[model samples]
Target: MTPGTRIEHDAFGPVEVPAERYWGAQTQRALAVFTIGTEYFPPCLLHAFGLQKMAAARANLRCGALDAERADAIERAAAELSRGRFDADFPLTIWQTGSGTQTNMNANEVVANRANELLGQPRGGKSPVHPNDHVNASQSSNDSFPTVMHIAATLEIQQRLLPALAVLRDSLADRTQAFRGVVKIARTHLMDAVPMTVDQAFDAFTRQVDLGMERVAGTLPRLRVLPQGGTAAGTGLNAPPGFDTAFCEELSRLTATAFVPNPSKFEGMGVHDALVEASGALNTLASSLIKMANDLRLLGSGPRCGLGELRIPDDGLTSSIMPGKRNPTIAEVLVQAGLQVMGNHVTVTMANASGNFELNVAKPLLIHNLLQSIRVLADAVRVFALRLVAGLELNHERLAANVENALLAVTVLNPVLGYDRVAAIVREALASNRGPREAAVSLGLISAEDYDRHVDAAAMAAPHGLSALRQEPSGTSGRG
Candidate 1:
């Protein structure tokens, strides 16, 4: 071995590792074999693995399997790792293996070497702190990796994505209440059909995100159940009696999140159904965000030529050649992000589907995509809310003009005056290029008095009962 490097031996034989690195032969071997991507498992996943190792150490000690001094050193090392220290020690890639055994061993080696260092021993020495027999105790990469996936995913949703979505919901709710009285034209099949308060449009988006939040919440129950105890294959071969229970208890104490062992270790090891369900919820959130962004883009289409009911935020970047063309850059970025999230959901689902019996070989892919979706979706929702939603302006003048000038605005009279009569008025309004009231007056479809009574745009935006329709307006001249 070189003066600054050391040789560590595993089942495969000897490997050279850096003198200062806390990782040993397994991690060094993985580094040499997998050069597929630049993306390593993020620090959160590494932190989760650290937490798992610490929990395992405590569980082993509780079961009288690990001596006090050795357990303390391993626990301290793992505790530091869980807090995200020494993340660089885990250099395995997501594409290394579908089962993520390489990263799992990377964690084991790092903790073991760190524990050895704490005991005043050199790194990679298998003496008092053996990676497998001591640090790993009764756990296997199969069980540990999936457990970390569940823990990491649960924390991400609770700490990042859900809170971000709540902020977005608040922004939309504020917009809805603020625009309650602003009437705007509503369309069906992309054709103007009637008038509706701008508030209703915003309300729909609010409800969509609310339901998405509920969908995201639904995933927690399944995610809370983990496969931490099932060693190599669901058999818990080397795990001590009640070890799984103790591990969960220690994990709950450390994380403050209730994590329970799965009753059916077989199912947990054989499939990632919980992750798939959670991905589906994330997919729903993405779809909701896309719809919301598209709606905003449509509303903020143009200041002079298009819908123009709402003005988009001026991002200070115009077309290089379009002179004064502003763009809905925030909304556009959100929609694209949502699309990537949707596609990531499909990747998770596809990976889950390829699961085989006793051990899911596709676990790494499932978690890689799941974590990515959470991060991307959280950022997208936050940016959309702060940049686009908060900056939106209600173009009241343009909105009122569109509502007042449209012929379909007369359709609200369908229940009051009957469809045939309303249709005749709309036809004349469209043919003459005049407002519905003017068309009614010019066509003599109904007296000017009745036209004024039924053409209340605000009332039409939110229609009422037939009693009001039957009650004739004072000084009515249309009954004749």
Candidate 2:
């Protein structure tokens, strides 16, 4: 211990704490007990904690339970924490007590110590702003931690993840419109199928993002309900009357997000099912992103011997061994991000299931994994939009050539000609290394003039009425 450090005592006994630190006994104990990973909650969550403390102080003051001076000191201290000035003070790991009681106490101690300082008291002096009596007035770890969980998760989604997804969606929509006329071969089961515009492919990707955004939006209503008033066991015990309503009102005002007291506070405390449901939505988004990124990688596979359809910018990254070789850096980045989020949902679901009795013990890990997925996904989506998807280049000549040489282009003739005849033509085109149109002509299945009109890539791409080369060859009536 440092020479200037002071010893603080709690139920467990005395422990030496650094003199410059704002946290007290409980926080110091937790810091020493959980010497696990360095993965702490982000600043946003800590800010949410500070904001919750501030709202509680205001609510307690408004309800006449707390005096003005103590409330003002706690409120000022909370505002500073909410502004993220004390993020370093919270060095506790994510792998802590299941109910996150230790972290809750960490917040309580920081707020109390800082509040005392605001009143000209020495650091660690919990006089006017007692950690539990004032800073954590009218609340418990069971209630306050869950309340901040919802608030932090909600804001992170609305302000960070959704906007990043919107940018990616817009980028895809732009490409869809820009490439509307560029026709390319469609692939099914990794085999050539038919002709479709490049825009059609991008349009599908845009719809995936749209649906992902909607799924995430669906979780907001449930998240807006808070369990802050139901301290200890959802009974609102020891809390002043009307405190719940006031706390919610003050919280809503402070966050600009409407929050109501949970009618069934027991359910909120007993099960983190709401978070599990939100994780499901995030998982769906990760799946969609992986599919889209994989598609981009396939499209941008090769500028020489592969698809050669789309070009992926390598973000200035080049292969060390093979100079001038650019990999699909952003696509790989999104794929790995998706994998992590997919894994995170499982952890959240399992943790939610492990909650016993009145309080779920998995609170710390739940919020940790949830915020981890959101922040990583948001950053990856933004990078994909601006650095990769928005700058994608199309190989128009390659696309046109692939569409021309497509053997399955004859599949369109199946509607007019019999399937057997079209199959024969497909085989002959592949074997003879001739275009489908030329095969159809040489096989005497259609006249050159009629083949020219019917088998055109663009014409077959969107056919209004069924018509074949040579108008259903004489004596060979269509199956339909």
Candidate 3:
């Protein structure tokens, strides 16, 4: 009777469950344990569960396991749940209870109970619509849980993560174009090695991100294979002959995403290799993101103390004690997010290895952690693109000054003055604490006008000169 108190169920017969156990007692226990500091629940998983229920109800209707009226009632309830209703009912504490049976039961009970209420029946009444008998009929926790996971993961990758990555990739490409005419010293092993355009650096970042997104995209087709008809042990013992294909087809139609019946129901139901593969792709993308974010942070480190190629926007106070100090907080957040995704990959890996032949007990944690990675990556990409990448300002004056001081500037004059003589000039410039222009003038190896014409930073930074150098014959002398 009381909100948080358990009430007796008549169908399962006199079983007293907590009133707050709307999703059942197991879910209530989980809600208390995995109480991490996340503000929002993973929408992808929620949407997947709702979509699965709708698909399953349709399948049951077609099979005559559920009446048309009840099927319609379940569909309406599922739609409402997908639209953000009954979220509180899906709450579960985050702890490994040997398997994800608790979580699956939570979805079953919530959807079933809600559907019953929508059909003008009492909370636990199964008269017109039964939760387990009709709604979850022909389904086991093993099949349903992983099916939902696969659905959720695929949708999230296609709809959320991929789009965010595209936005970030485009932003990086724009930076590459904008910096095409700006030359900077290319550092190898933290020492200047050659002259390169700032555009080249941004292009490298864009390429890694684009490749990472490709890897992520490549994993989606594999992720669409569902373990639905496998039932308990991948034998389809309880499920009808046509249930697997029909259910998958219905799911595909309902979610508007590809959902194929897995080739090996045993493997699909018992092992989580698909999840491991997907997580691996996410980890790869996250690593690329970390590298890019780190580079941006270092490049924009300080106006006076470090390589100040670009400046980040000041959003909030970076510290409590330091004034006028705006830190690369956005970059820092992106780094942290990438780290979280890597950790999630590790979790999925461990879970995948721990599974046995009949069922993987790690479904709940696997889905939870994988979904966490997807959400974090999607948000991080968006934030970095809009707040950090798009707003980045190049300090042209500083860039030019740094390029002028770099000894690698001798690279351009190597064509006119020869490598041996240019190498001598570079050494002299570094030793005398003077710029290459001043050193060249004092050394008398070059006229002031000749040096200016051959080694101007602006000229060297252009794509034409760089393209020519790239096209040059390796063994040939650098003469016009």
What local lDDT does model 1 show for residue 36?
88
Task: Indicate the residue-level lDDT of 440 in model 1.
Answer: 77
In model 2, pairs of residues that clash are: 98-361
Q: What stretches of model 3 exceed 4 Å from their correct place?
A: 1-6, 10-13, 18-21, 25-41, 413-421, 441-450, 456-480
What are the runs in model 2 whose C-alpha is more than 4 Å off? 463-480
Per-model tally of clashing residue pairs: 0, 1, 8
Per-residue lDDT over 1-480 for candidate 1, one digit per residue giving the tens place of the 0 to 100 score: 778899898998988899889899988888888988877677888888888999999999999889999999999999999998898777777888778989888888999998998999988887789998898889898898899999999999999999999989999999998888888888889888677889999999999989999999899989989898899899899998999899999999988989899998888888999999999998888888898899899888877788888987888889989998899988888899889889999999999888787888988888988998898889889988888887778998998788778788676566555678777888888788878898877877677786677677787767552325644454443332
Model 2 Cα shift for residue 121 (angstroms) = 0.4
Please provide, for model 2 over 288-401, each residue's C-alpha lDDT reduced to its tens digit, 9 standing for 90 to 100.
Answer: 999999999999888798898997776888998999888898989999999999999999999999988899999999999999999999999999999999999898888888
Q: Report the C-alpha lDDT of model 3 over 1-480, residue by residue, as the tens digit.
A: 555566535333444456643464445555666675453346667767788888888888887777898888888888776676777676654454545666666776777777777777655555576667766777888888889889888988998999999999999999889877677877888787566788889999999989989999999888999989888788887676788888989988877887899989888888888889999999999988998899889889886899888887776766778877889988999999999999999999998887876888877778888989998999989999998998887888888777868888778776666788788788888899888888888987877876666666666655655425533345443443
The RMSD (Cα, Å) of candidate 1 is 2.3
Worst 10 residues of 1 by lDDT: 471-480
> What is the TM-score of each predicted model, taking all chains together?
0.95, 0.96, 0.89
TM-score of 3: 0.89
Question: In model 2, how large is the Cα lDDT of residue 245?
Answer: 92
